[model samples]
Target: MEGLDPRAFVLGCSAIGAGLAMIAGIGPGIGQGFAAGKGAEAVGRQPEARGTITSTMLLGCAVAESTGIYGLVVAMILLFANPLVGKIAG
Candidate 1:
């Protein structure tokens, strides 16, 4: 750390943060998979309710997917439009 440039420090930290942010995508993937599996089970149990089950599952998946999208956006910002880099005056 003694000889590290301020800008280099900021850029390195931003890269780490962006990597961490990308991990957030995992949760939504798991949730959507679980939802789909459950939806399939529900439809199997009640074929007449297939439409309702599928629609609800899709809606839930869409909502869950937003978190992943947000995480992606944040990661992209951290990697490309990093504000912290600008904050480091030198």
Candidate 2:
């Protein structure tokens, strides 16, 4: 058989890019888990400070969410912008 068609090649690159983008999820998962554990420990130590601990935990989690957002942006770029297509076309 002949080599892949242009569309097929673009699709293959998109698939690879999607996989790479998903890998970024790992960072947020680990970071959020750590933040959750710390929040629990803090609440356990000072029951009266539960509110503060919860707020801080949520803030940290929100920060961790940024990594996932980055991943989504990358995936979107891969699916939409698809820089590799330009190279292939050239």
Candidate 3:
């Protein structure tokens, strides 16, 4: 039997890794959107609380953004440093 080409196998692994990495974005996107809506509603209900609401909302957004950042890091690793490629090569 013939063996698989290293380059083709590596490219396929990279594609799968990229797809898996992007899946992480789902959490942050939904969480941030929900936070934004809640912030808008909070400001609507109590205009005087705008300062506090905005601060809290921003903090929530920052936390939520971490997931997206993690996803980006994974994607970068998959595209650039693909550890699986090393294992396959070895």
Which number leads on lDDT? 1
Candidate 2 Cα errors over 4 Å, as ranges: 80-83, 86-90
TM-scores of all candidate predictions against the true structure: 0.87, 0.83, 0.86
TM-score of 1: 0.87
lDDT of all predictions, in order shown? Answer: 0.93, 0.88, 0.90
- lDDT string, candidate 1, 1-90, tens digits: 698899988898899999999999999999999999999899989999998899999999999999999999999999989988778764
**lDDT per residue, candidate 3, 1-90, as tens digits?**
269798777878798989899999999999999999999999999999999999999999999999899999999988888777767645
Error of 1 at 16 (Å): 0.8
Q: Which candidate would rank higher by lDDT, 1 or 2?
A: 1
Model 1, residue 55: distance off in Å is: 1.3
Best-to-worst TM-score order: 1, 3, 2
Let me know the TM-score candidate 3 reaches against the reference structure: 0.86
Backbone clash total for model 1 is 0
Clashing pairs in 1: none
